[model samples]
Target chain A: MTDKKMDIIRALKRAGNNPISGEELGGILGISRTMVWKYMKALGEEGYVIRSSPGSGHVLVSAPDKLYPSEIMDGLDTSIIGGDIRYFDEVDSTNDVAKKMGSSSDEGTVVIAEMQDSGRGRKGGHWMSPRGGVWMSVILKPNVVPAYAPRFTLMAGVAVAKAIRGLGVEASLKWPNDVLIGDKKVCGILTEMDAECDQINFVIIGIGINVNVLIEELSEDLRSSSTSLSEIKGEELDRIAFVQALLRALEDEYIRSKTSGFDSILEEWRSLSSTIGRDVDVVTPQRIIRGKAVGITENGTLLVETAEGLEEIVAGSCIHG
Target chain B: MTDKKMDIIRALKRAGNNPISGEELGGILGISRTMVWKYMKALGEEGYVIRSSPGSGHVLVSAPDKLYPSEIMDGLDTSIIGGDIRYFDEVDSTNDVAKKMGSSSDEGTVVIAEMQDSGRGRKGGHWMSPRGGVWMSVILKPNVVPAYAPRFTLMAGVAVAKAIRGLGVEASLKWPNDVLIGDKKVCGILTEMDAECDQINFVIIGIGINVNVLIEELSEDLRSSSTSLSEIKGEELDRIAFVQALLRALEDEYIRSKTSGFDSILEEWRSLSSTIGRDVDVVTPQRIIRGKAVGITENGTLLVETAEGLEEIVAGSCIHG
Candidate 1:
């Protein structure tokens, strides 16, 4: 950990139940009081809410930047997820950063970014995230083989759905991988893994959400098929608070998933899935299958009742009607 | 095309069974005769055998650099596949460069390098290519679904094996994706694609070969198992010629696999396979199946005939006895 991260931790600890003097805090961090004020301002810019006083000190009344490390540190109660956060102003991609950190960083470590210049989606598609979006990539060192790793994608879908519902938004999952609001997509999860034959080195789950982005600002194609939290609610919701809820939900779901298996996760996913029982078309290179969406297996495959009988689709683009 | 490339093409054309004059060649390229001498020297360093004289220009006798775009171009008889070449001294990873170029470059352009700072293998393992190895990434715009993109790995494996054997090297293929020399891996292929649910934007095939690598300088584990062409032949082979051969073979195999089907390729793979009809242990995430390596399927899966039953292994590390 760098000295900057430590100072942020110390500041949060010192402000437990009360405000800490900025001058005194600056002295502890071995910087000038003005520098301390600048650090506080930086934290505030990142979403930390430190109430300022003229002579007393700085009070951390509420976590305005809930996803910021300082705000998430003492507030986050999860065991592993978000335990160590590496926040970047701009990066090629959070997934790329997480991947580079995977061998060295512990499991459940998360990398969050304000914006990505090279954000990636499934199959290497460009994920367009300008700013004011929830873009994060989490590193998971699961003790599973590469084939079974796809189940993590399904697990994350369930977690995202639950987190969105917690905010009173009606979000549903589509088969294979998609989170939709009504008929439009609100979020997309990309799960990339590095694995040998039977062993998995690490997996990076990159989740992109439309948080406070304006609909008009989206690309022409995305504008018609995507929805934002602010757009749906007709107001800008607290990003920090939403991310906190999401990380907490993700941690819980991930634990349940690895230990208890995908039964409950699949059930949760099914309930929130809009693709189930819908007429759909799936195209693979070998053949195209059109059928009624029946269910999802534990391996995260979609079971469709096609003309040839029941078939499982490990991956495909889904169009629901 | 740049003037340099065009000048070389014109010089080769003008040679016409007789060497062109240096003064005339310099005039054509709009460079001084001294500059022409320098270019010839650079071309010589790149492994082009140019017959030169005091007044005579130069005659192309042979190519030197294996991964030179001109070599691949000469070998390719297609409209695409080797249209453009981007050579790098060193890169973080070729897949990354290919991904960046994937959206902009033509469908079949290729990126070649002698080394990489962060060369990647399947599952994030280090593809250690100190020097004297083939490290290349080809940009391909294959209009297919993402699920079928894994086929590119299998297809590339066949290409690598075919190209190596065309050089009379005893190269065989391992299950799902690996080109092996005897019992050790000599090459690895990584296929990354960008796609929507049903449509693929592009795919990058990052290939690494242990050609001309000194096995003695390798790590203990690799030193004991791995073998290289130079080590086997006890001499340095022309890399440019080898690259040309490999690209030619790859272009042919790619076309066959994508257009005709995997049946012909599977047959070729089976003939070159050393694992089939042998005792092997196949490890997957769900379970371990130990049995006779009976055969490989059209989809590049290993068919293991165990005491329990015959099983199909999609992806796994294979141990053969």
Candidate 2:
């Protein structure tokens, strides 16, 4: 149903400034030219800007900046992750949606939303998810122990950093799962899972990227610490292209972690780490440790050389000192 | 509503062969004599045999072998676990019920069933749960890491073994979570959990004990490896009493694990261990290892001393050699 409309939109997108003829779209979609014309009218209603001249056919001017499945799937190069994408205009949390999904859902299924009402970070901390940000969660059924869950968070952080860096933007990973730009946070990763003692049932890695969000819209307290892509770049980013790259990068890392092991990805993580080699304050639930950030453990815990000794903090809030 | 009937049943059972006057039952229930008689009639319809005489008020002749909430709750002394028991005549699996339960469910909630249509062990291995067995799951939301999950399995094994031993039966715990009577298995535990890398959402400890199941009625292959309480005792055992004791024992161990850490329970597990100091073979998903079961690790993994030196097998099927 939406496939024909999507094919026309994709074909028009590929045509750039050139108009794609109705005959060509009809042949591509295996529909009649009359149907193609009807579909163009439908696309216009769906917020697609298509200019049609008397001599030239339909040319795609612009697409609505919506994270719809059709838009995200247009150029998504991933073979697994995001292949079965569920797009929501607004959701309480993409992680919640993924958690409630049945085991029958595909392993690499992804849930995406334009806005989140109750998005959260690790330990149920609130996450600010505006409409312009990429609020998404990827459902992965990795055959690993629940103890090894933080590895996925580390993997996702590396993927996000890699994708952001690929766009010529400088991005770095903070300890645990935060992506930062020069000591300000731009993205946070929350990993949740269900498992047995020996096996993992599934893991939902919630990734909240403040792409086109306005920094001023956040609470005053967060303004100094939190930053978005649009703020750093002084302009809004193409979220659709960013998401395609993110899903592709995430899928690549996820597959690599499964096949080669997490060490390779961990190496990439260390290279992009902003917390390592810095004096930091790691606050766990029990106590706060002031130390020089040393390195990360194989289990994805932060190893900090404190005044007392070297301490391995499994999960915590890392504050750059 | 059922609590009233349970109170009446408990009163009658306390009276033994002697009949409890209607006045006595009414006083204990805080109800009128007529109400007591009506409740007694209802209990009779639900398979309790009450012999009522004109002068000798009412004497409980026998209770049905049903693991009803009233039956199990009558003498259950647990402060936490089994406080909110959901009993079913049959279910696909008690673990499935607990897994499907919402986070709002109490931390120490219990789900019990008389039989499981598709009972499973670790790695989705089939478990034979007959009508007279105690196929149950206990839900615990411990504030611990997901890696600590296997410790709960070990804790549960010790609890089961201790409870069985309290009944004056010779029961021992095998590595990773199996309770054995001599060389045959009488109980198997499956601990499943939902957690993040750092915090646990909840853990459902599924325990399937062959209470009064007839060994001959089991599948031919299972008959040789499995033993039941009836086969050991040469008569049907009291399931209601056994469940009450098991729940109490489990709650004790669970609380100890939370308050004092799992070391104490680990010590008890080691004491009652049948696998330790025995020539054994442990089969894990990755490989098989034959060694003398030397000791158990703090993480609840089996420590086997092999020709290749010491090995810690986290999860596996243990076969006594």
Top TM-score: which candidate number? 2
In terms of lDDT, the poorest run of 10 residues in model 1 chain A is A63-72
Candidate 2 residue lDDT tens string, B1-321: 288888998899899989889998899889999999899889998889999988878888989889888778776777888879898888998998888783658988889998999998988789999888899999998888887889888989988998889878899998877899998999999998877788888999999999999888789999988998888888888888889889888988888987897789888888999889999988877899999998988878888999999998887788888
- Model 1: which docking level applies? incorrect
Report how far off residue B166 is in candidate 2 (Å): 2.8
Q: Against the true structure, whose DockQ is highest?
A: 2
The positional error of residue B125 in candidate 2, measured at the CA in angstroms, is 2.0
Q: What digit string (tens of lDDT, one per residue) describes model 2 on residues A1-321?
A: 288887888788888998888988899989899999999998888788899987678889889988888988877778889878898989999988887783558988999998999999888788988889999999999887777788999999999999999878899999998999888999999998878887888899999999999988887888999999998888999999999999999999999998998899999899999899999998888889999999998799899998789998887899998
**Tens digit per residue, CA lDDT, model 1, A1-321:** 346644755676666867678667877788887777777777676555677788777777655433455555546788888888888878888987786677678888989987889998777778888678888998888877555666777788888888889989999998777799889888889887644334556778888898887878878988999998889989888887778888898989889987887798888888889999899998765677899999988777789998889989867778886
Candidate DockQ scores, in order: 0.15, 0.61
Stretches of model 2 off by over 4 angstroms after superposition: A1-63, B1-64
Error of 1 at B189 (Å): 4.9
Question: What are the Cα lDDT values of the candidates?
Answer: 0.77, 0.88
